[model samples]
Target: MILTEEIKRIKSTEKEARKFGIQVGLVFMIITLILFISDKGNSHYFFIVGGVLIILGQLFPQLLIIPNKLWMSLGVVLGYFSSRIILFVLFYFILTPIGIAAKIFGKNFLEKKINIEKKSYWNIRNNHYNKSQTEKQF
Candidate 1:
């Protein structure tokens, strides 16, 4: 029983982590799109708001696992700032390829290559239930 409960908790954590990642990616994209289309003067505001939204999206899903709201919020804030340099480096690695391609082939070509809106990131990986159901116990 204990092992089963632990497995369930682990699965839940994985689910939440996936959801949080998707949310952060979505918010980041939306904020980035708005910033890109808008004038340069409004970029500072978008950056601040985008940072806040990403942090909130990252931490909100963990609220159920974390009991103390204050500590959770504090942790989120500290995590963002403390790891920012590392995160920026990671971000560059993750996004730089796409950025370079966009510059070369143009943004529209890149968009046509990977259209997130039509692809629907959240709906793409829905094999979990089917796979679990199909698994047999010996």
Candidate 2:
């Protein structure tokens, strides 16, 4: 019985992640369109809508400024269907790289990027190797 409950929980979590991904993606679309169409003719409306959407998208993954690959894909789809031509082109460029990278590296590309953690200035100055106090004395 516990196993069944665990499976249900896992599935729910996965579903929620996908939902969040989709929502963020939609926001990305709005962001590009808003930025591209800012002008006097109903452009301001698009711009505002787009801005709000982008903000929501960004807030979805708080502190993660760059939306993930899946979000980018959704954004492109949303942007392409948007009423403005300029917005479509802009979003296309923003999202194409995701497909390209995925094609080149498959699903592993998004698993985790190799991030070099920051080391202390002393460590950097001394390189990664630790210095011995006795050696310094000599």
Candidate 3:
């Protein structure tokens, strides 16, 4: 049977998840080793756990499915919140001050005008194009 695009995508995701699990397991093992070398009391317990994780990740990556799903879900949630906060900071702190400064300097980028006596709101522009400009066809 021919594999669908979604099936291919899911296979790739599973592969990546396996890699992520292995990497996390290695990191934990490294940290445990460091702690052990430092003569930390709880290092043995962490080392045992990290060794188990490394073995599981290497031999039975399927067992990491739940943990992988949970990690991905947490990343998605954190990314959503962090992106909103970053955008809010950029707009409020950076863009707002720039906009206020532009207004103070009488720089109307939007070309807004306040005139009570104006009959029409249309600001007509000269649409006349020269022969050389038309020939360019940009």
| Candidate 2 C-alpha RMSD relative to the actual structure | 18.3
How would you encode candidate 3's per-residue C-alpha lDDT over 7-90 as one tens digit per residue?
Answer: 333333456667867788788888888998888878777777777777777777888777776676666667767989999999
Model 2 misplacement above 4 A: 1-12, 39-138
lDDT of 1 by residue, 4-119 (tens): 34334433353454455456556666776777787445656656665654555466655433323333455556665678878887779878877788789766642346665675
Q: Residue-wise lDDT of candidate 2 within 14-102, one digit each (tens)?
A: 33444554465566556556666663345555545555545554555432223343444555556545747776776688667777777
Task: Between candidates 1 and 3, name the one with more favorable lDDT.
Answer: 3
The per-residue C-alpha lDDT of model 1 at residue 34 equals 77
Ranking by TM-score: 3, 1, 2
Candidate 1: stretches off by over 4 Å: 1-12, 41-138
Please, what is the TM-score per model?
Answer: 0.25, 0.21, 0.61
User: What C-alpha lDDT do the candidate models reach, one value each?
Assistant: 0.57, 0.52, 0.74
Error (Å) of candidate 3 at residue 116 is: 17
After TM-score superposition, the amount by which residue 8's alpha carbon in candidate 3 deviates from its true location, in angstroms, is 14
Candidate 1's error at 108, in angstroms?
Answer: 69
The most accurate candidate by lDDT is 3
lDDT of 1: 0.57
lDDT of 3 at 134: 68
